[model samples]
Target chain A: MIRQTLRMARWEVIKLRRRWMPWVFLAFIVLSSQLRLLTEYQMYSNADPGRIAVQAGPANEEGEHSTISISCLDIRDGLVESRLSGIPTEFRQAALQEVESLRDRCPALLGMYDFARTNFLNNATLPGSLSYGINMFGTLGYLFVMILAAMAIGVEYTWGTARQVLAKGCGRGRFLAAKVLGLLAVVGIGHLAVILFMGISSLIITYTMAGTGISTDVMQWLRPGADVVKSMYMMLPYIILGTFFAVLTSSASSGIVISVVFYISESILRWIIGSYLGPDAARILISVNTPLWMASLEFPALNNLSEIYNYLRDFLSTFLPILAYIVVFWGGSFWLFKRRDLKPSTGV
Target chain B: MMASNDLVIKTESLTKRYGDILAVNDLSLEVPRGHVFGLLGPNGSGKTTTMGMLLGLVRPSAGRFSLFGGRKPHREALTRTGAIVEFPSFYPHLTGRDNLAFFQEISGNGDSVELDTLLEKVGLDGRGKDRFQTYSLGMKQRLGLAYVLLGDPDLLILDEPTNGMDPDGMAEVRELIRSLGDGERTVLLSSHLLHEVEQVCDSVAILSHGRLVVQGRVDELVRSLAGETILLRTTDNAKAIEILSKLNWVTDLNSKGESILVSAPTLRSSELSEVLSRSAVYVAEMTLGHVSLEEYYFKITDDANGDTA
Candidate 1:
């Protein structure tokens, strides 16, 4: 059975490679990663840092709002009058210290762009791109992986090849298991491509744009690597769900429709369940927990103890349910494939 | 009785039900080793259903079957068996050779040389590189044959394998099936084409309304089901019946509208006529006639239909 399954898996990858959809999906991911890197770098590079405007974000519950519209040069030159005038009274003192620090870094106008470039490099580079692409991979991988899983499983029944396979003594359970594993391999390779592509391209872009002062500790990647691992596992539930629907309905279209519908409807369902019920109810959703679990790692390690605590809470809550969904969907699919009589393909 | 070891397939009251419909009912059957066996049935007669059950595509609702004498184990038995239960289904995107290669590899015969040989055996050489979706129906059927021939399986089960093929393609497939079943291997063929079965099968089981109507060697069943008949117009019809009835080969002797119908081998028409003339019941007209498998099929199925009605 194991040998047969491996053969099936090897053939599955071969079949998928001969097709065009997976490559197109991977291309979209790789190109999108580069596009984002270029877009961010372009936004920062084109800015006139000498006269660039700065603004604070919206206020907290304590009404601590502050908006700074003064030019960077005004702050860089220690022109305290122009900078302090527009700032609100609640944030006036803290804003002064921040401007003073920037003034010290680029007290000369010639260094303002250099100073601003250094700040933007980290946001557009390897360590940042990992987190950035993790979110992107999860979102896009769910869609692509779900779509691929549907195609991989659905086409067997639609083409009546499942009959051919089972007739050849391939156990129905083994066939499905091999198929799911094959799909995971395809998606795994796709994710790896995105990670490598984004990492390489982001590094190249940062090294080209920053010129110098781009020192990143190797440890900075450890968190993003963990998130990457998390994002990869996150696509499993969708794969199983797609496989389940494909086998249950015995059509690729139903598999695709239902899986996509589920993928799309999940957020709405989570929102509805959460709104009328509560957030705890929403966190029960796999996709909902995924982003929260991913976002957990983004919480700073500084004096953000409570934020870290919430991150831990979401992480702990996220793991088991995602695993449970995977087990349920995969088990349901295997049972269906094993027990149900395999009819020839009815139609498209 | 054929030894149990000689039976490649044995079913004991095997049955399958889809809701209220009995797709296959108490199907007790055997296909002896190294014989081309025909499973003949009309549409919905459970021929394909029975094959499906044997090949593990459909689970039987009742009863049990053992493949290859149940000695080598189920999966191993299947590995030595090749089947095309319904139509030839394949990935439309794959080239014919690629599709063969895929199933070939999965069946554990990853030999490229064997795949090419099977493709050539099915007369699908050179055209094997074309995508399945682009191939004509005949080409697709040929590809299916190639796939089934992989692993050099000992037993081959084909259900309407020649469907969607031209007459020439049908003949080619028929010849291929006959060659595959030549002394060394067993072929369980299910086809609605009685003539194809007649030409290729060594033994057959005719199914009617999900029940076995009759089973025997093609020659025996065709001979016995509606025994060979001689239509005779004579000066003395009563005398002709009397004379022919006395012959040991004559199973039934009766008078029809204007002639005597003697149920005996049409091959012995000369002896029959000579017997009549010798008996002084001189024949004005005599013509040899016999029921073919087609005629026997309809006759038995109509009788089966009548029985249930």
Candidate 2:
């Protein structure tokens, strides 16, 4: 059985390698990531720290230079408050030591020093935007994975290969199992490629922008390794669900149609319910709700065990619906596929 | 001349239904070992359905069939049987060799020797590396036969194996099937072409509208019809017709100049000769007629007219 499974896997991999779609999707993801990174870099390039301080009010009362001085004072106070918040005592002390060293080296710009310290300290307490970007893109991976799964099974049926496979004495159960495993393996590889490309591209863009002296400390919030791992974990049930959808439908077009419709409906239902009935009721309607919540909860960083536990509670509450969906869809697909005649091209 | 241990396939009232239609109704047949058995039928005559049931690809609505000695299509039974139902389709992307190799693994036939010999036998020895999609219709048909022959199966069942092949290709397939019946293998092939079936089959079963109309040794079936037909040439053809007209056994009497052709009921050529000689008419030439399998098939299947023997 293991050998048979391995053989099927090998065949599936070969088929995927010969196909052009996976490569095309990978290229799209890479291009999209680069485009997003470039846009983000341009947005941050013109941002003025001085203007930001003036907009906070009372800085104009001090006149031009006095306003700079007042902004510098405000920056100092904000830094102190941020430093005293949740940071470890040792790290705070080290940070202060670094500030004193900077003061000694550049004594002429005390106002700028104070502002720098305040900005650094305040930003340290905030989650990075990079983490948010990773989390957002990670969620999108689920949809792409579904599309890949649909294409894997759908293409074979559309091309009339499933019938040829069945005619070889491979039982319907075995054949379906092979195709599912094949699709998952191919989709998994494609997902990894997208994740890797996005991770590398984002890192390069962040490094380049930071080299140009643009402060992008908030970019550290998106941890590539952690975000990818979490996203993949959340994508497991969705992959299974997508595969079931592909197997249940007779043609590729129908599978894609059904999966897209189902996913869109769930998203719309979740949005409507969340707006009207609160998050608790909304969570019960979306299959990916737990994953989304888990992803969001881990963003920035967990402050304490209690925060983590609360997030887990929310995730678990949302998980039951996804669990039920997976069970119904997977089991229903298996039953339907096993009994139905595999009229691949003739559209039975 | 039937061998005691000869029968390779035996079906008893085998029936199959597709919703309201009875596709194969109470089909009982016996195919002997080491003989090419032709399933002669037109479209929708249940030949493909019957082969499907025998190969365990289709479920019978009633009755039973056995391959070798097994009553059901067990793994052991299927191990010794290879079939190509309807149009033989394979993975078009895979090379013919790879396709055959895959079937070898599935059939659990590890003998590379058999595979090589069978490929060569079907004239597809070195062409196995070519992808199936690149192969012509004739090549695909031959490869289909090669796949079926992978395990050197005891019985080969093919439905319309030569359906789309040209005359030369059909002839080659006929020779290939005939070669399979040389010593051990029993081949059951279904075809709508009567001449093709006649060329290769030693025995044939004729099906009409889901029912078995006739079946037996091809020679016996043809000869049985032959015995009822006689051709006569006489110097006094008018006298011969006059004498033949008085007999109730003679029908379809045609007098062409000095020759009279008539289908006789039960009389042998020698008996007819003796009667004609006794009537004082010198029989110039007398010959026993042989009916082609096609003619015999038509005689049996056409609306039974008592006028034509």
Candidate 3:
């Protein structure tokens, strides 16, 4: 059975190799990185240092108007006047306080921006924009990867290739299992490409626009790397869900449609539940639970889990629900695929 | 001629029920080793359904079957068997050679240079690299035949193997199937093309409405029908018919033009010759014509349906 599964998995790899999916995936990531660089460059070149500079304004002292310089966060503090000026003043203090708590964060953003516009100005470091790029992947990359997963399984049925493979004595479960592994293998390689492409692009853009002043802080570099890991953990369930819907509907379009609908509906459902029942109660939903799990890792204050009696409670709350989602979608797809007959769909 | 132990496929009371409809009912069949066995039936006669069951695609509603002497269907039983059920299914985006390579890998039988050779065998030598969707229907059918020939499986189950083929392509597949039956492989093919089956199969089973109507060696079925018709041309046909009608085994005697048409259970031209010669009616010509499988197939199916009606 293992041998059969491995063989099926290898076939899946060949399928991706022979098709346009992997190339398309790579092209998409590169294009997205380029777009990010372009947007960052535009924002960097347009930045007016005067915005965050102390401005003399009419001050009311004893009901008399007098010129006084407003005190504000300074560029000398190694902060970008552009990104900071956009923050609403009412929340400016809070945001600054948060940034101050992570002292090494601002220089990286500022240096990344300056290096994006000037090649010799600053040296961009590793994991600079990869942290942000992976976050984007979770949304945009999620959709593309889901589409890939859907096609991986959907083509087998639509083309009647499932019958051909199954007729070779491959168990249904084994075939589906191989497809899932194949999808992961493709996604894994795609993720590595995204990281390398996005990471290097971020460095080049940062180094070109800024100067050779990027932080050598190992801890900050490690944070984005951790984010990549977390995003990967989150991606597995989506791939499995995509495969499940693909096999169930027997069409890649339907699988993509259903996955998007389910994802959006889960978010909507979480909102409705949270509005009526309370935020904690909304955590019962996977859409709420998964993001909240990531939040607990990124921002402990979001869920107040830091005050929980057991330190492991927050981890369990997040891990179990996502694990359950993986089990239901992945395991359920295997079961259905195995139990059903190898019937071909109406189209190729 | 192969022994029971040499049977490649054996089914006892194998049946399939789709809710209230019996798609295949009480099908008991034995395909001996080294013979090209044909599953003959008309549309909706359960030929494809039986093939589906044998290939483990359809779950039998009742009864059981064995592949390669095993009493139950299992993966190991299918490792040495290849099939094309219904139509030839392939990935439209992949080339024919890639499609075969894909299955070859999944079969865990390792790679062989036969991939291209099999394509050539099916008249797809130069076209192996073409995408499957670009091919005509006949080309697709040939590719499907080539796919089954992979790994040199012991038993080949093909359903309507020549359904979409042109005459040349059909003849090519017929020859390929015949060549595979060279005292080593067993092919269980199903088709509505009776003449094709007659030309290729050593033994055949005719099915109608999920029931086995008749099954035996093609020659035996034809020879069995041969004894029923005897044509005699004599000088005194009227007297000869009268005398032949008196025989215990003779029936359905009638006169047409100057000749007599008769149905007899035991037809021997020698006996009739002796009887006619002794009666002083010299016989000029006497022949026993055999029924073609086409005629025998329809006769039995029409009779069965007539009885049902």
Judging by DockQ against the true structure, name the best candidate: 1
Report lDDT (Cα) of residue B85, candidate 3. Answer: 87
Model 3 misses residue A322 by how many Å? 1.5
Model 1, span A98-120: residue lDDT tens = 66555544546546566556545
> Between prediction 1 and prediction 3, which has the larger DockQ?
1
Q: What tens digits encode model 3's per-residue C-alpha lDDT throughout B1-309?
A: 446588888888999988899999999998888889999878988988888788778889899888888844578777788888888899888899999998887777856588988888888899998999899999999899889988889889998898988898789888888998878799998888899999999999989999988888899988887778776789988888888878877756757567776677544667878888888988887667656888778767987787768
Q: Which stretches of candidate 1 lie over 4 Å from their true place?
A: A42-120, A211-216, A296-314, B226-228, B233-283, B287-289
lDDT-best of 1 and 3? 1
Model 3 chain A poorest 10 in a row by lDDT: A65-74
Model 3 lDDT per residue over A272-338, tens place? 9999999989876766765655552443444675555355677787888888988998888987787
Model 2, A68-171: lDDT tens digits are 12222334445534533554554446545544444344434544544544443222222333343344434455666677667777765665556545544455
Per-prediction TM-score of chain B? Answer: 0.84, 0.82, 0.85
Candidate 3, chain A: TM-score? 0.69
lDDT for each residue of candidate 2 in B252-274, tens digit (9 for 90 to 100) = 57764567777885455666667
- Candidates 2 and 3, the one with greater DockQ: 3
Clashing pairs in 1: none
lDDT of 3 at A325: 82
Q: How good is the docking of model 1, as DockQ?
A: 0.66
